[model samples]
Target: MGFPSISKFLFGPLVPVLRIEGIITPNTTNSIGNKLRKINTSRTEGLAVVLDSRGGSTGQCQTIRNQLLQFSKDNNIPLYCFAENFATHGAYYILSAGNTIYVNPTSIVGNASEPQADIDFSQFLLKNQIESRIIASNPLVNEYRFNWAIKDSEKDKKFIQEITDRISKLILGDIQVSRGKNLKVNEELLTKEYTGKQAINNGLADQFGTYEAILAEKFPLAKLDHTSLTQFSFISSYQWNSRFGKAIPLFLLLSLFSLKVFIKYTLIIQSYLLVSSQEEGQEKEKKVQH
Candidate 1:
């Protein structure tokens, strides 16, 4: 849900490391605001911040960018980007907040700027819905058909293009200013989003390496907090440990029943084999006597 433990101790004569993740937006800022506040003063050789997210609201992106930029300048510590996966959108901008950006070659640093706008627009719609409810409750606009449609063709087109241009510029500027940006991406104004190979060719990511290389280069003693989907747990196991702390009995009963059935079937098979062998031995003795 959030970054683990505002700090981690590292190798090399007591170093400090930090990590960040998720969509970079207002909540992202809120989530880390306390952590950031607590980190007003810390002297260290370098600071490493890792990000793994698809990005979030632009406003949030701007807030985080400004906040981290100030932190880096004020504290005089080098900030780095450890790209674990697709560091897309606002996440990419956060990576730019660092002094150096590192990427795992196979890992993706995606370009999904359009999605960020979609999120902001979703928020705008929610706001409008609330306002519409207020208007319905109010004495105004209930008596007339509100002309929400835009009849101005030229104005609408101009407005649309202006917003498009603004979003494009925001995305372009973020990429251009990234710490790992070796050079400007070709393609005028980035008409299309780039992926791993294209991103590298376009200079979005500086260089790629294995996990070991990346950690050693940036966070020599960085311990990745990772999760795997392969872990399996039986339903009855939950009751035995009571992770929920409720100590439910029904699940445990079902588990024991299943085990008992298995044991019974196994015993039956063993008895059947033993009886068949004894009967065969008697038949052979009768044949020998005859």
Candidate 2:
């Protein structure tokens, strides 16, 4: 109360910064969705998303991108994206939602591709004496589970490739639309990987700088309050586990020791009470005899 809380008075309007680090799985997207609901855009000038992910679930990536787009549009606020370390493929998809994308100088940028199967492993299976015969009523469903099926069936390969192409296109489309004249969209650009500097030159990124510095420069009037910003701290299982898991064993041992001490003291008190009662009984008997 003495200084009137600097954040509320000095900063003016705060900008919400969200950090999306590590793998973006279905669970990760759900966590993001929960956090997004908590963000009150009315109190903030703009939203800053700091992305640092290699790549993850394609479907979840699309969901996160769509959600971010909706949040920005609804709030009528600028959504700035800064790649902390790197943002590639699925991560890039989310980054594309930003009005301006920034990356650190050394951060790796793009690598929008899918996994490919190596040569057949039937011989290896035979060598290992492994027998696995997957059966499904539907051909597509069966082929979906069979890794080696792609080698034999052109249709299966095409089917897998088509989905990969679609996911890549989604990333490209967002980047192209967001960056507009800055980005040069092409087949090579979509397939090839780029360094942070290369990404900036190619228009994949608007600038190369830290998220904090960019926010200070871009939104001069806005204050960056990390406490008010949306945090994924609540969603991490490891943090909770590490916090409480370490203490559980120690707590159990202490509890056992305490219980043992309690039992020992109780027995000692019981023994003393029994001896006292016997002495009282002996004294009463002597008086009766007298």
Model number with the top TM-score: 2
| lDDT (C-alpha, whole model) for all candidates | 0.56, 0.74
Q: Which ten residues in a row have the lowest lDDT in candidate 2?
A: 230-239
- Candidate 2 collision pairs: none
Residue-level error in angstroms, candidate 2, position 207: 1.3
Write down the TM-score of every candidate.
0.52, 0.67
Which residue pairs in model 1 clash with each other?
Answer: none
Per-residue CA lDDT of model 1 for 51-113, tens digit only, reads 777777767766777777787787776665667776776677666666666676555675635
lDDT of 2 by residue, 1-290 (tens): 34433333323456777778898888878777776787655556788888899878777888998988998898787889988777887888788788988888888887765544447766677778876565678767845535652344677667767877776666676667877888875756655778888888888888878878888887665557554464222323543454457668987999999999999999999999999999999999999999
Candidate 1, residue 136: how far the Cα is off, in Å? 12
Quote model 2's TM-score.
0.67
